[model samples]
Target: MQTLPPMLNLNDLRFFVMAVTHGGFAAAGRALGVPKSTVSKRVAELEQALQARLLYRSSRSFTLTDAGRDFYEHARASLIEAEAAQEAVQRRVAEPSGTVRITASVPTAQQYLAVHLPALARAYPRLHVQLEVSDRMVDLVQEGFDIAVRSHFAPLPDSGLVQRPLAVEAIVLVAAPSYLAARGVPAAPGHLTGHDGLLTGVAAGTWRLSGPDGARMEVAPVPRMTVNESVVLLGAAMAGLGIVPLPQELCRAAVASGQLVRVLPDWTAGSVTTTLLMPARRGQLPGVRATVDFLVNCLQPAEPAGSAGQ
Candidate 1:
């Protein structure tokens, strides 16, 4: 068998590099929190392993020989690469990295995520986000999604997924100024029966509302048009098509800008609770967990300092 080279000790290489950069073993040892004798011994071992003199030592003179200069160049480069490798791994462990795939409803993605996700990017530059916008409910595990945003009137069924409630926004009836001008705004839920109704979810459904006096009723209106997407419904209402029930946040700006007006001030169409869902397995990942926490912080009220999730 061919004679194999001696195994090189990484610590010895580090000590040799430090000794050269710090001017001497004593100074290097001070920087390394070790004794000068330990630094000298390690450097000596490194030179012996390489079968080359990497440093000259005497009573009054200390310097690098021709062999030492060549070895130092390669050794310095190796140490730099090794440190860079170490830092790369430490960054992955300490900070969030890798791609996180997320799914959300069309309206939520546009109004909330698109607005807030830029902050996530600024906070963790190493992290990558893949956003999927869909109005239909997605199977988190089956669809291979890391996270999903869903809104429901009732409690979500136990689907073996971790659920985090983001917000509970009241559904309000809104109509364009033109429609309210022509159709007349309904003062009470009963008055909504005849006006042209724009609905979102089903082809035909009731507007469940409760009054300021705690009276509740459901009015099934004949649909002028129906669509499954909330954004489409918002567009229709803004175009003076008809009154549509929408999450308060979805149309707050329109209502503020005088483009649309709330039909019944005291009554709501009901509340839709938005929840963030993730697979139990996926939630355990560092990248996914950080993303979930970031979204929660953005949507919910602020918690006390240091109480933020990991």
Candidate 2:
């Protein structure tokens, strides 16, 4: 039968190393911010555990035995390694100097994350950001993503991840000015049927709209083009292909630039809440935390901007 190695107390070893290095119990106690008696007791306990006499003590002086010298050398080496390990971890925590892998929807990545990343990089010079843009729901832990930005109409499904609200995104009908000029703007939800529709996969062919007075209407226009990605639908709308519903944040610049104009101004095509999510474990990491804070600050400003139309 194999025998297990003896267990050693690291704290006791540390005390012994400190006592020897400081040349006396009182000095070691002062250095460690403890009572001298506590230092002496810890050293005694270490010696007892080792089953060897490690020090020679007199009222006037202190000395180390040959055995104590050998033990001290090894103990001091262990302390050095422990301190180095601690400092290595602390340095990473102090500086956000690592790759942060993020997964987000195509529109969020293109409109919000991709455009804003340069600012984050400038703020955290040592941080490397990796973005994965997709519309599929990502398994954060399984896919090794540090964070994710997700959009939802209802509450997010229970995925056991920590979620922080990023923005409440209002979906609005948008069309290229040329398209609206050619097809004429819709007076209300009922009139949208006369206009060509560029539909996203999530919306299928149906649009659910809410008016200013809490009245809801659902319209299903024949799609001239269908896309699974919001960014693609936004592009199709900007190309004067058809009217499409998009998050206001994604189309805000276009609206301001006269590339696209809001249709049915009194009615909105419902809203979806955007959230930042991460595995509970990754949420505590310094790099992940910094990225989350940066995104939160960026997205919060868009909320008021989105509501300015109302």
Candidate 3:
């Protein structure tokens, strides 16, 4: 029969090492933030467990026996190794270096992450990412994704997932200058009845618009074409096919380049909030957390210039 080695109390080993290094139990207890009596009792228990006397204490001095000296050297080495092990684990937890799996809608992946992720890779050279772009509402846990970028018009339900709002993008009606000039700009929600509409998503035909004075209305525009893809709808609008309501971020570059113009400047087709979602458990990992913060910083709309210090 083989015998198992004795299992030692880690606290006892720690106390023993500290006692020797500090020259006495009292000093060791002070360094360890414990009562000397507690330290002494723990050390005594350690000696009893090991069946050996580790220290020789007299009225004049405290010294180590031959066995104690040998034990001390081994104990000191063990403690050093133990501390190094703990620090290694802690450093892994602190540093962001690992693969992070993410999911985002096609438009979001293109308009935001596609442009920003290269910078993230440059900044954290050791961090790797796997991005899955789809319009499906992915089950983050079941699908094994670390993070998800989602956009919705309403507050997400209580799904027990952690969600961080990245930005609120205004849904604006846009069209090419040629299209607007030919079809004539819709002066009000009612004026959209005759104009051709290029729409996307589930609520393709209907548009919910809020006017300048906080008045809200809904309009069902005449659909020239309806598709679930925003990029395609944007293309159709840019080709002067019709008007389309899209998130401002999607059309920002086109608007800047004069390829598209906002159809209703004083009215908006509601707003969609871009959110960062992650499984509650995965949020604790260093790499996942770092990626979340980085994406949030990159995607969130910047504050208007000169708005600070007010």
lDDT of 1 at 117: 93
lDDT minimum window of 10 residues, candidate 3: 301-310
Please provide, for model 3 over 1-310, each residue's C-alpha lDDT reduced to its tens digit, 9 standing for 90 to 100: 9999888998899999898889898999999999999989999999999899999986667788899999989988898899999999987777789999999999889888898899999988878999999999999999899999987767799888999988877788899999999889888888987888887755568887777656777788888997887899899999999989888889999999999998878778777778899999999988898999998887775431111010
Query: Of the candidates shown, which would achieve the greatest TM-score relative to the real structure?
Result: 1
> Candidate 2 has what TM-score?
0.66
Clash tally, candidates in order: 0, 0, 0
Candidate 1 error regions (>4 Å): 1-3, 56-60, 88-99, 114-132, 200-205, 211-227, 239-241, 301-310
Instruction: For candidate 1, write residues 1-310 as lDDT tens digits.
Output: 9998766888888898899899898999999999999999998888777888888898677799899888889889998999999998997798998999999987778978988899999999989999999888888888899999886667789999999988777778899999989988788789988888888767347777776756787787768888977889999999999999887888999999999998887777767777899999998888899999998988893221111010
Q: What is each predicted model's overall lDDT from 0 to 1? A: 0.84, 0.85, 0.85
| TM-score of every candidate | 0.77, 0.66, 0.69
Q: Model 3 — TM-score against the truth? A: 0.69
Per-residue C-alpha lDDT of model 2 across residues 50-118, encoded as one tens digit per residue: 899999998987999999999999999998999999999887679887899999887777777877899
Better of 1 and 3 by TM-score: 1
Query: Can you list the residue pairs that collide in candidate 3?
Result: none
At residue 68, candidate 3 shows an lDDT of 93
Native RMSD of candidate 3 (Å): 6.2
